[model samples]
Target: MKLSSLRFFKEIVFAACLAVLAVGESPAKVLTPDFVDLAEKLKPTVVNISTTKTLTPQFRMRRQPSPFPDPFQDFFEHFFEEMPRRPQRERSLGSGFIISKQGFIITNNHVIAGADEIKVRLSDGREFKAEVKGSDEKLDLALIKIDAKENLPVAELGDSAQIKVGEWVMAIGNPFGLAQTVTAGIVSATGRVIGSGPYDDFIQTDASINPGNSGGPLFNAEGKVIGINTAIVAGGQGIGFAIPVNMAKDVLPQLEEKGKVTRGWLGVTMQPMSPELAKSFGLEGEKGALITDVVKDGPAANAGLRSGDIILEFDGKKINEMSELPRLVAAEPIGKAVKIKVLREGKPREFTVSVGRLAESGDENNQKTAGDAFGLSARELTKDLAARLGLKESRGVVVTGVKQGSIAELGGFQSGDIILEIGDKAVATVMDYEKLIKEYGKGDVVRFLLRRGDSNYYLALRIE
Candidate 1:
């Protein structure tokens, strides 16, 4: 009797221990949604915006009389007052979302660029006129406010920087003016540069975003706002770009505080050093922006940045590529002193730079040009390069061949024309031209200078 009871008790104890172990050692959980409750709760804040602007059209003078006598017609013309303005309403559509319980909205700048009237429609079909809070053309971001009361639904914010490729994402917007269209896809890429802005670090997604989706929210699967839908490649599908919310966090506060953004500037035109340039510079790694021009009285110039200096880091952020420096410098707090690392003459040099506020207008840098003639190409002449090119003064590049559609003819370059330097640089040679074409590449300008038969000319060329 004692052995049977003891065995039964032992078996029961073993079974209980196994049950506890099973509960504690379960497999890792899946990242899928446990419920769609969060998404359902946040959908109400999404909005559609319709804007209209009134334009006065120009009218031509009447060719023939209105069946009136000559004296009468002349009197009517002379006696009549100025013609009344004819109002023509032009309409545009875009998307927006409520960021505040009190009805603050966010969208792209282009959405309301010339809008005279803005109407925001909520998910409940309620429409309200929105007033502009702030807008920035540099980053294409806008914040608008609408009057509303009571507690409202707000989408949660997620760390877009923490998201990775292949993670699921969703977008809700008025694509092509169609209200509340939902698209789903994975994060195709991160930190995409589509020539959008100086601080363009876009999240590439397959989610379909049309013209009207400019200000829509790119939501994570958690129903949180991670990015702002901003652009779509025209004539392309499954290609869309969103501004990462993480990058917006700092700018958002400034936008809300002063209705504008104040960024730091080093006053330099920089370019990524190619493999050839890197070898010539004796750089061990292809890292850092090659300073081409340092603005007079700019932070960089004050900090001792010089042409051919390769900036390697700022504030301890390892700058592996040249593209990272512009936004990094601009994002810094103005008037703050920062440390900059550079590679000069095959050695590392560090400098302390007092950061300066970025001027909204005017050229950021200036470099003397060297106009010269090489084997096949002629370039801008500066004291430095002119010494190399046997020239005495600064001028533009000279073209010997007007190749068909090969940067020359397409640029309207004549056989003997000189090409003055365009953006970032004053006058340019093939090297400067290549550096410039590869640098400050956020725009469509590919300007040049031309000298034809002893006459100087300036030409606007498109960088294809």
Candidate 2:
């Protein structure tokens, strides 16, 4: 064969090799979405909830004059009952999702609080009147129900207990009344508390949740609902928190079964006893909630529990701190017999106690009541502070020193204030208060009904 013919054959082979290589190489990454489908699928179920609450005429306007202007004060209050001297219309917006086919939806309680009318607008442009099924302000969660002739789209609930930090997540809500807006980000953290309440184990995310996004769905990458957006810490952008679906699950059963939550009470005030206090009492580990006071006839009392006793275990789980007790106990059923382990005076002891139902606290006398003790230095309420606060208590205990702005101070208790009760019982004597304080190895709260002069006050001071 000729040299030119041989060269032509080699060129053809090289060209074929290049063609095969091109075919084998993977294409540059293009969007083959996992989230786009999620957005489309979940958007329909996410709804806009608008609440109309009537506020007193006084509440609508600032009692303290606005620093900026007062041009509308006189004209605003006159002729317009809506102006807020008597009654006025107050409206707000939030986000929600249909959790059931029968129009069961979920949102934040603050969204619909005091709302005389709740209107829910769907992704399909249809609107319906929604009724609040139940709400728990302690958790900042609420369940709403609407009338729908058809089965509504329900988002899938995922196990939040399985969620991890830094996982990709999506938030769907009505941001600033823009319904069904979707933002994407990763989970920033978990188990965060923003002074919302006890049991605040939140899933933090960088999703763009704004003013109207409260009570919306925070979905995992697999399109499962893992959390419900509740709040954003102030001065924080790209930071928001959601109630873990697991916590939401705990409240849903009660909301569906009963219109309100019924929590179990041990009638004990408690707190996380510091390592110093724990060591002084001979506690083995630094963990466990310290019982400040066990109520008379309360489940804990019947079980031989006492103040200064460190609760190590409830049922089968170990108690790590005093704040952990309420979330655990409230999860228990009333009247249920359960095992409780405590470290008494440095020794571990165990017992069984029947839980008790909690009832409304405080009464008309504005007399002191609730909790078990006030750890601060206190004395019998005198006529001086009573006259100053405009309260009428003569025998109630007065707070002399709040330990230099401790939890009591932050709880709105001042020096010279009066205390009324522990948990639910009245404290008429320092012995009564001491007994209550002794029951708690740590301090959770000292419920007080106070008299300052002509005024009576109810204050819950967090001891833990």
Candidate 3:
């Protein structure tokens, strides 16, 4: 090789090395976010929340007799009975971030639920009494307000829909009562449904979120709040979950205006579309929610949606999974007519249905009773019937009749058996039983807790 060619080759390699170094430096700066400055700016927006709940103790009758003699026993019994049982106060700590200069804050509903008094403490050593403006138990979110009487430092809300996994994030909360604690880690995952609730779109992160971190702010690299730290896996390290800020933002207006969330209801019970079920439906792949049942006269039913229909899209959004449909349906405005694309018997169809408001409590009148499906007739347990059944309390539904050779009879259900619970949820009324029973579909094995002759026993019945 010539000397001039060798020198030119060496110079080219050196220039390429310099170009690589320049490209790497920019991403290194982007990846290693300045947490110290971010923490200082966000600390004022985050606040410590302390709640006090008054719990009244229930007195249970003593079952065993005193070990002492009659006179000593009588004296001890009277003395203990006369003693006053005072109401107990429980104190809990959580974290919240100011969203508005008018003192509005966002936190998890579990934090301030049943709290008789709530106190908010700012990082500047100021304290104020807070009140719950609105709460949604289904979403586990609460909007609270404090009368600071001045403009407060508010956190910048970011679009969580743009958040991707492996992005650097920071959490600011009062974990374990440690106020203004900051933790940083990358987003572990997104759209995680850990069975938290119907809308279980949580942003999973490795940020250290502890007991008292509920309702804190999860920030992006730009110091904008993207999530609300809400839950953590028990005994698991670097596993935490946060509510997406976009969801919170959607609920905030309703919470601030109505003091409760009124979600749009589709009045349909659905299950995940499995590959086998998809094949049975003549679908190439499992990409839609399979409707198990539709409430009679419901918005869906009125729109001609049937039990066998497969929901492919709702309001223009593609329904890729069963879990996505509920969140999408709930977000729609009530009374607004929206297009629903469904596959019925392997044929495409569309329907325009007006969304209905979901009742906060399950409305039994609107729900389909479980009698026809289960082949059992049940009546609400009245006080008179409770006495007849030798029950101390009038609760649950008493089985009035059972069909011959039906699933109920096969499951050992008798006429006098009281249905206490269905599928692990307590059935205090016939409505509760009906609403819960409708959640299961064909081929699903459902467990029922029955109180038969002063004893409780669970019965497993497969729906055929």
> Which candidate ranks first by lDDT, i.e. highest?
3
114-224 in candidate 1: lDDT tens per residue?
Answer: 789999999888888999888776788899988866766676678997988987788888988888777777789998765444576889899777889898999887788
Off by over 4 Å in 2: 1-33, 59-84, 360-464
lDDT by residue for model 3 over 1-464, one digit each (tens)? Answer: 69999999999999999998888888854567899999989899999999999875433333322224465656765776777878889999999999999999999999998899999999998999999999998888999999998999999999999999999999999998998899999999999876555698999999998999999999999999999999886666898999999999999999999988888999987877888999999987899998877888899999999989999999999999898998998998899999999999889999999999887834564333476677887876655345544556575678867775577775678877888888879887655777788798999999888877767788888888
TM-score of 3: 0.75
TM values, all candidates:
0.69, 0.68, 0.75
Better of 1 and 2 by TM-score: 1
User: Which residue runs does candidate 3 get wrong by more than 4 Å?
Assistant: 1-30, 60-84, 362-464
Scored against the true structure, residue 100 in model 3 reaches a CA lDDT of: 96
The candidate scoring highest on TM-score is 3
Q: Supply the global lDDT for candidate 3.
A: 0.86
Candidate 2, residue 346: Cα displacement in angstroms equals: 1.1
